[model samples]
Target: MAEENKSCAFRTSIGGQALIEGILMRGPEQQAIVVRDQEGNLVEKVEALKFIRDRYPILGVPLIRGTVNFLDSMVNGVKALMYSADFYPDEEAAQPSKFEQWLDRKLSSKKLEGAIVTLSVILGVGLSVLLFMVLPTFITGGLLHFFPGFPMWGRNLVEGVLKILIFLLYLIFCSKQKDIYRVFQYHGAEHKTIFCYEAGLPLTVENVRIQPRHHPRCGTSFLFVVIFVSILLSSVVFGIWPITNVWLRTAAHLLLLPLVVGITYEFNRWVGRHVQDNKLAKVLTAPGLWMQNFTTNEPDDGMIEVAIRSLELVLPSEKGKDEW
Candidate 1:
């Protein structure tokens, strides 16, 4: 394979993401997108990513910086998708597929599409509030009604139990989708490529297939941290829920999201970097690793090839700056 023959030229740690009909790769210096067009030809685009850290040192601080990084990634990802969409000709665009037609009919306008996406995210948070906050509160409040004398911490205990149940069910349901399964296969491809590179193996499809699919720095792990952190943080802040209003409690949870994400980001980063030699790091990451069974599957060589090309386009030419 080309990756094996040109191993030394490739950046070792660059990673990739599977997109709707393409791949996105992020290297130290640049991010690249590659998509298969309607004509089944590969089209690629590359962009240099200059971080604010180069100019303002203070902006690079841990917690403060993650928020900006998350937001930037979201915006850039959308732009990359839009750019790739251009590869499909106007005639092809007019005869939209079921998903495209659905999106078109529902969104109607670009502004409407943006609004819908924002609303969808908000609705997701709203559902989380409904499950973790309102439903749990109701259940615990009912227990209080039954016992007529339960302590303050009892509410938090019940809420935690209910939240865990809700999270588990959500994952189970989402994992059942056919398209989601395909995406998960690509997810596995992403992890295996990173693993192959980290292990000093030549980054070929055959070599990558032998590498593990579970990645400590995965978004899956970040979510596990969010759930676990919510439990811990809520135990402190929402424990005495009998004394607080529901709206106030929900607001607190919403506000704490950035903190949770930032902390999880930092932890996952540490775990990914250290899991090679550290038993404790592996232990901490076990749940997320197990969860990958539902979120990742064996990808075919074609998918891996797309991923490899995506990674190649973004990799740094310079030494000592090859992280994905």
Candidate 2:
């Protein structure tokens, strides 16, 4: 009977990430990772989630929670990625260097993994900030130096354009990679399954395969919104206090990142809530959805099966409990 009801009504807070030959789904109470091994058998690992907010309530506050949750997502995502990668190791994974070997021997296995995952998250965040935030500011400021008469607004505009351009190019580059294409296909499957569930349809291969691959609440959308919000916020801040030096501008951009993320998170929540009924909300999410063109591809039946199973594991026992 539930399978027969296809009327779309609400969205769920549950979301997922496409991984190497796998999918990771996060729900209200837990997260699950399902991977298709070399033998074509499905294997899964599920963990009960413990929220940081549960330990520190203040971190759950709206604006503050965005940054907190982003970090939490990064950590979990990296851990899941590592786990999935372990199943499909490189053809030639180099031997650990002397220092790395020393650390491995010195630390417990769990501690070593924790250290590596923490380091990966840090490096990931660092690389993202440098490439997307700092690099744009550096280029804009460098160019503006040659034109002393360029207005602050002009400088901000250039930086914003550069940010968007770099973001687009990065996605395009990733999409072109042979390995990433499969991940993107799985990404599509994730979106499709979420859409099918939200529409009250049974999660079947036929149902999910026909669903749109792009989702407004996707991480790609949130990332784009982060850049968009930063552009708007930076324009205002840079207008107020013009910082011409590349290094100073880069520092200012870094400082504003948390605020940008917070605003984007709140905006995403609002958009996610209103997208079904509000015209403006739909418009707001269009670009991010469009960006999915590069980040998502049509998944095959097996990939859809992975998505469906991954979603099933994480779905709450109570209906409507996961409603956004």
Best-performing candidate as measured by TM-score: 2
Compared with the true structure, model 2 gives a TM-score of: 0.96
Task: State, as a TM-score between 0 and 1, how close model 1 is to the true structure.
Answer: 0.78
Residue-level lDDT tens digits of model 2 in 1-324:
123223456889999999999999999988999999999999999999999898999999998999999999999999999899888988776666799889988999899989998999999999989888999988887787789999888888888999999999999999999989999999999999999899887899999888888888999999999999999998998889988888887888889999999999999999878887788998899899899999999999999999999999999989899999
Candidate 1 lowest-lDDT run of ten: 1-10
Off by over 4 Å in 1: 1-13, 52-57, 80-148, 239-244
What value does the lDDT take at residue 69 in candidate 2? Answer: 93
* Tens digits of lDDT, candidate 1, 183-212: 677778877777676656667999878767
The global Cα lDDT (0 to 1) of model 1 is: 0.69
